[model samples]
Target: MDDDLRERIETAAEKHALLNAVKHESDADVGAIMGPLMGENPDFRQHGGEIPGLIGPVVAEVNGLSNAEKRNRLEDLAPEELAEMEAEEEADDSLLPDLPNVEAYDEVRMRAAPNPNGPWHLGHARMPAVIGTYKEMYDGSFIVRFDDTDPETKRPDLTAYEAILDDIDYLGFEPDDVIRASDRVETYYDHARDLIEMGGAYTCSCSGEDFSNLKNNGKPCPHRDKDAETTLDEFEAMVAGEYSSGEMVLRVKTDIEHKNPALRDWVAFRMIDTPHPREEAESYRAWPMLDFQSGIDDHLTGVTHIIRGIDLQDSAKRQQFVYDYFGWDYPEVVHWGHVQVDAYDVKMSTSSIKELIDAGELDDWDDPRAPTIKSLRRRGIRGQAIVDAMVGLGTSTSNVDLSMSTIYANNRDLVDDETDRYFLVRDGESFAVEGGPDTAHPPLHPSFEDRGARDIPVGDAVRLESGDVPAEGDRVWLKGFGCVRRESDTLVHTGDDLDVVREGDVDVIHWVPTEGVQVRMRTMDGDVTGVAEPDFGDVSEDELIQFERVGFVRVDDRDDDETVVYFAHK
Candidate 1:
């Protein structure tokens, strides 16, 4: 082995030494390794006292190893040692779910198949969050299946691909692979052809409304009696682009009298003349339905468990039917119920939002008012806060409303540790009270032990509330932080006007001096409340602090020097 390789093995050996040391500690203490702890991090190598006798086996298995072997080795150490080792492995960005104990069962395979017909809203965003969570919790593979089988309604937009990927990444998930349904039309066609030859599928020239009526009437179509050979011939012709769009559709040969009409004689494939953006004008023209694509792709990718929202439970049944047809092993599914919000029932869709966007009624999908991942990110919602809310929710198939208020209530607590503090004055132009030269104390911060940052210098500026100044005297309460004296009210607009610097007539707003570098924020606090002048320079993004008087805020977007931030507002 090379010198570097030799050095790596020695490092692994040393890691075991440290693990041994930590295991020998009086307390079964766990050491937190800040970075990669696999090899040289001896702290993780040791077995705790809880499983004292089993450490020998772990050491024997780990002791003489090649540099590469040590790096990739899975621990069969004592229970305590294995737990710590598993934790270290997990922290490396792989959520390996429980491995099956038996040797006969197949590896679990799962995927997330989302339709590209519309922009992915909040609930759609929840899919990746749940998938990533389970991927971490269960150790499974996740594939992003872009279900663009039906090209008719799926709009041609460049932003669609970038938007979906950005949202997933923003929520902290980088899928190992991404599969677009449009690209796999040929694969789906081949599978459909296989089913057709096996007498499991047939084509029907049924009209849309007529087919629904036929389904409701429980009548079998004449096409159902067609021979498999004729069906296969027509299917081939359809693949060769012989059929026009919507002229005919190929469906699985399921019974029309089945209780679930949706399952009864369901369309498995369709002909879409709409040009696919990425696939271009390839040899294939027909495509399989989403559930078909999901079933096939999940097995192909070797996904073990699927953690999807309960809204797709019906979809599971349809996809499961596909699995049953092929006699394929189905993956386990844990469905969390629909995460809803009042007036933002993503259970249906924001077609209205899309319509508004297209009609120019709404500016864009990222409109602050819109309930989408992009808009939420732009509006300063912490990705962590969203995940926190999800984890805390009791898993159920029941729907729940998650309003901006609900999020803010949780996020308010999420941001309560930072040292950032300031007041904002809205509507009023200038303060009647002045600080000509005198400076006053503002307690550094509300709670020194809890809020004040030793890194940031506290300001001692005499701030004033524009509306709090008494019309008669210089007396002013100065609000939450301290009191200020009214020197004079400068009315540049109207000399005698400006409400004559009235007291109690208008509410006074107090704010720190602009020298601290103000940060502007916009959030839904019952309504649209914008904080245009916040003392952001005094706060570090790492410091998750509460804005005593204001709601919870987490600084997400920031400039090199200092600039207004777009933070998660709760």
Candidate 2:
């Protein structure tokens, strides 16, 4: 087999296999490469992409594919298409629309508000990232509301508000202003009063158990017969703390015989004994239920559109009911399927992440192992990479985990050439050069103009890797410096003469001249001892580099003489 024919066959086989694994790409892509190769080399044979009259199917253009990749795509097509391969390639942009026709508005004048009982997590970030991205595209305003009326379970820290705000800012989302449920308490009371007057909502004196059982089968409470005047008085008493906690509850009067039990007579407000973190020990004991708060807020804000998870699909039905009672316009709601963590094969939940953190298995909320935005950022995963991984997954009604780290791996590979390389030494292992012949030090990333050649003087006593140091007559690589047939591990490079070397690696290890400054680094896994790359003192926090053969690294902190860094997971 001649070199040209052998090369073409290998390339064709690899392309064919990659297409098999790349579920997103079609076979026609393989023909682009094979056409040129088979035409140039007579010995090569092609399978797909040569049918007489069949035209090539159009495929969406995925971002980040190189021209060479585009060529490889041709080989996967039918053989007939190769003969008529002169068809022009028109770029596909269906995945992301130009959206010129979307009417832009400045502010949401609309309804469901954020659940602010906890800080934003990866799941919480999804809608906001999409909405915020769209919001910015149209210069629109989004309200950041604190759904704090449900004080049934309050965070220990009163500053839960600030923590949520901080997380939102960290993710770069800019809301128009802060909206709190407490601020609307009087507004809710007035609306509840009006609903009672209209007989659309009723004050229920039923116990928690009775209230739940009431939805199972329609039955009117003795208090349900009270006139609007009496119901308003009772609601005022409940708000005024005249009634003890849970003594009276307010229920929206949906159809009592509704088939969906969840849609029937849902509680609109209840009294909770627990003191709110924000409100402190005030005697105001009544609290608005989540459904009522969210529904009314979205309506009041004039939110024209709604996007939430499928798990919250019930929210749409319930919110629609609220609109029906008030005769208000219902907003357009678009729900997305669930996002799951590929490794766990379960929906990524903040509670699970917190559980891991609480167990001490993960370093912090932002630890790369936790899969939070901070964690991904710490891992050197760019925001755009996360967004891209999400965007291409075809949206379906069914829930599935689309996350795959390999997408980030593929992205990182494209930018590898631009990454600087550094030699990092492991503990119990280090290299020494026979110091005699070298002249001056070369740069860590050698320039292409100078190639990789160094001007260091010739040395006979130069050291080989401690591992590759020959037992007696083993050969080893001197790395970019060159290969050397090692005679012994003890050969230290003294500043004197040139030593000849050849390649034979048991394993290539790292080295630094005995005289340079010694530095210590902390990797994500553990502490490692390595010669710091020269620019380690000069590089900014955002800069990342490949630590030679070890892994990718980014310097996170510089403490006096010590450096703290994070290593990429293998």
Query: Highest lDDT, which number?
Result: 1
**Regions of model 1 farther than 4 Å from truth:** 1-109, 279-284, 307-314, 334-336, 343-350, 429-437, 440-482, 485-509, 512-548, 551-570
Task: Give the Cα lDDT of each candidate.
Answer: 0.56, 0.56
TM-scores for every candidate against the unseen true structure: 0.66, 0.73
State the lDDT at 340 in candidate 1.
71
Best by TM-score: 2
Where in model 2 is the C-alpha error above 4 Å? 1-113, 137-139, 154-163, 169-172, 279-283, 343-347, 355-361, 393-395, 404-419, 435-480, 490-531, 540-542, 568-570
lDDT of 2 by residue, 516-570 (tens): 3234544444456655533445556756766665667666766566566666532
lDDT tens per residue, model 1, 1-570: 345433443444445534543333321112322122433333333423322233333444544554334444423323334344433332343332343432333433446677765667776766676566766655556678777666557554545776787777887788878877677767887888788887788899988888888888888877887888999999988888898888888887776887888777788878878766564534456767767777777777776776666776766777776677788877777777777755443333656678768877556776556777776766556666565444444355677555444444444444444335555433223443233223323333655644433222213332333444446434344433233444454211111222322322233334544234445554433233223333445556534434435544555446755443444552
Worst 10 residues of 1 by lDDT: 491-500
Question: So what's the TM-score on candidate 2?
Answer: 0.73
